[model samples]
Target: MKPLLLLDVDGVLNPMSRPTPDFHRYRCTVGAEVYTVHLNPRHGRRLIDLALATGSELVWATTWEEHANEWIAPRIGLPSLPVIPMRPGEPSEHGEMFKTRHVADYVGGRPFVWFDDQVWAEDEEYLRVHQGLADFLLIHVDPGRGLTSRHLGMAHEWLTLTGFSQGS
Candidate 1:
């Protein structure tokens, strides 16, 4: 089975800083409110490169919704990747869990690694229960720095263990 790399935009590819000129700017509306976002295109490119090299299918698991392809993909150099849209009618409070389930469904029988900052114990519990025999790698990004060298190292290790890649 092909392995999947579930990518989250905000804190993973795009650091949630106020302003960063090098990053791609985005705006979204949540019901009555509008918000702006900045995506670190350089880091996004780096992550995309890793995804391509490892032969892992890339799926968008962010609140960007369907806009991930039009707004996020071209900026990051991945235009043709398939996006896993957030679950319909999912409550905003449990968006993280919704994303997790969407990712699981997208990958189907394949192994997967989910990179996100908002994941909690609930998400982990859900994965533990529904993952069945396929390996589910949950990579939690830190608040301030997103994914660090240590985080990547850990992901690399997990990828190796799951036979997604041959570790260096």
Candidate 2:
């Protein structure tokens, strides 16, 4: 089975920081709320390349959910991809981020790499204890810096080392 490349929007793609030259600022409207998003167009190409090289599927694992495909993906040149359903404002039963359990359920024993700002040690422990879960790498992106090339390199290294690459 192909490994999953799970992405989050707020802190992963749309960084919560001062705009840099590499980032373009845009106003995104989700329902009645207007949100300012900073996106780096080059990230789309890099993520696509990583997925192709590693034989993984890109998936949205953000609270933005379906809105990510509509507002964020096109802006970054990413194609519409699968979204992991998230219940916004719902507290997690396990004391980890609410997305933790849902992510485990969504992967269903498939190896995955998740990029998110809110993931913590508790989240990692939750996934580790989850039954029927395959190996996963949870990358904690700094909300201030967003997704950097270093993070991508780490993911690439992990996937290749874990035998989740196409060459494997």
Candidate 3:
């Protein structure tokens, strides 16, 4: 089975600190709030290239959920990817991200790389002790810079060292 690449939207792809988006900027209103995401076309290519190179199946693990496919993916030039179903809200422990608890359920023992700005040490500890995952990379990206070639390079190296062969 192909390894999983769990992607987050806000920080990894749409850097919150980038004032001027290099690609198209989109705005939408959800209930009482207006949300805008700045996307770089290069990031689209880079992410697509990463998947092709590693043969990892990209899955959306953001609050954006299915909306990622409907809205964010198109703007970022990615085709529809599976969205990790949101677990009903959980109160987080200090230093624990809300998403940590659901990861193992979705991963189902498959090796995975989770890219998110919100990853914390507690999440890693929890996974190490509880998840029984054979291989995983919890990549923490800075929201200020989003993802860079350096991050992709690290991913390539991790997969190489872990002996994760491409499936497709």
Best by lDDT: 2
What is the clash count for each candidate, in the order shown?
0, 0, 0
lDDT of 3 by residue, 69-161 (tens): 887888878999998887757887656787887886788878888999999889888777764675889999999878778888888778767
| Whole-model lDDT values for every prediction | 0.69, 0.92, 0.81
Q: For candidate 3, give the lDDT of residue 117.
A: 94
What RMSD does each model have against the real structure? 3.6, 1.1, 2.0
List where candidate 3 sits over 4 angstroms from the true fold.
19-21
Residues 48-146 of candidate 2: C-alpha lDDT, one tens digit per residue: 999998999999999889999999999999999999998767777677998998899899989999999999999999999999999999999999889
Q: Model 2: number of clashes?
A: 0
Model 3 worst lDDT window (10 residues): 16-25
Q: Indicate whether candidate 1 or candidate 2 has the larger lDDT.
A: 2
lDDT of candidate 1?
A: 0.69
Query: Candidate 2 clashing pairs?
Result: none
